[model samples]
Target: MDLVTLTVDVVIALWVVAVVVGIVRAIKARPPRLAPLPEQIRNRFEVGWERISGRFLYEPQWAVGEADSLVMSLLSARGQPLDHARLPREMQQARHDAAAAANGRPRDKTEAMRQVLLQYRTVFERNLGPKPRRTAPVPRREVA
Candidate 1:
């Protein structure tokens, strides 16, 4: 065969091989499996928050501890990217503050605890969509 014809045939063969490989890959490809929060775990989160807000609202130390636990659980479940070490560092500091407060440190760390809660909430909301609204139904009065 002529040189030009031979080159054309080789290019055609390479194109065919590439097409076959692509088709095989497409056929074998599978979507990534997301680890969604299980219903039971979600229930635990709701209950934990309710307890913190209802009974521990005035107790800054307790509230921050509970919120921190919830945030950590969420991050663990969602498999958050750990490329930057900042988040973990912040979490560790928050945990230490909570411990200090729990041990009855002389200085009041309520403000620091509140900041931790705020940061935890921001992270939680960013990872898991918006938080569901928690509201009580109003009672309707019977008209005479």
Candidate 2:
């Protein structure tokens, strides 16, 4: 019984120490330097901006759908890359599309963003093709 009590006390003490350490770390940690956050967020916009070769825009899944033509049209009106000059409008349209996708039922906004991301991921998979490549079957050799 005494052993159990001592173990419990040690566990509690560990938890308290952990919480204090977390608090100290949080206070001392510096916030990451970032560009000013835009007023709105667009679907897959961030992903595209971050990629080296830019897998976000050219890939199949990230490719805009028929319903998402508004976005493409807007991008076309701007320049090939949809330059940051029109970021505000682009973000607005993205939010509009997000709302349209949600329909009537209330959903988590983050989930909507994730859905948009997944849509692009599907495009990526389609464009990239299956992971394991298929090869032509070889004819069986006859035993000598």
Instruction: List per-prediction Cα lDDT, in the order shown.
Output: 0.66, 0.46
- Flag clash pairs in model 1: none
- Cα RMSD to the true fold for all candidates: 9.9, 18.1
Provide the global lDDT of candidate 1 against the true structure.
0.66
- Kindly list the per-residue Cα lDDT of model 1 for residues 27-113, writing each as its tens digit: 645322336676667667767767765645588776887787787777677665433343455666666666666666446566566
Per-model TM-score on C-alpha atoms: 0.46, 0.23
43-116 per-residue lDDT for model 2 (tens digits):
24434434512443454234334324434433443333334343344344554555555553444543454566
Give lDDT: candidate 2, residue 54: 42
Best by lDDT: 1
Error of 1 at 113 (Å): 1.9
Clashing pairs for predicted structure model 2, backbone only: 60-123, 61-120, 61-123, 61-124, 62-120
- For model 1, state the Cα shift of residue 118 in Å: 1.8
Error of 2 at 57 (Å): 23
